[model samples]
Target: MKNLKLKAARAAKDLSQQDLAAAVGVTRQTIGMIEAGNYNPSLQLCIAICKTLGMTLDQLFWEE
Candidate 1:
């Protein structure tokens, strides 16, 4: 199963799902789904998350 290290990283930074959702123009539920690995965001959404986290997609979302 894939994991959302992005969500974990965001939490480490003390960001709420609502906060990330607002920053990425997505719903809080969307962030929740992403965090739960129930949703695979589009490239645009991925980029938005990366930008908000001051990270690159490669840094945030990569298979281990």
Candidate 2:
């Protein structure tokens, strides 16, 4: 499934894919792929992304 929550959180934080990727030490395409559900990020990467966005892993990566 698409990670629309991730996309929305990023947008609410005013971060572009490139900005988020740079903060998390990944490529912009990686961020895009995550949001598109084409990529499954490592736990380390997920934590990095959550930190950069001021979110928790559960808030950003968990599915209900």
TM-score winner: 2
lDDT of 2 at 11: 100
Q: Model 2, 48: alpha-carbon shift in Å? A: 0.1
The stretch of ten residues in a row with the least summed lDDT in candidate 2 is: 51-60
Clashes of each: 0, 0
Model 2 agreement with the true structure over 1-64: per-residue lDDT tens digits: 8999899999999999999999999999999999999999999999999989999999998999
lDDT of 1: 0.86
C-alpha lDDT of all candidate models, in order: 0.86, 0.95
Q: Please give, for residues 1-64, the per-residue lDDT of candidate 1 as tens digits.
A: 4456887789877999999999999999999888888899999999999999888888887876
> Pairing residues by index, what is the TM-score of model 2?
0.97
* TM-score (C-alpha) between model 1 and the true structure: 0.88
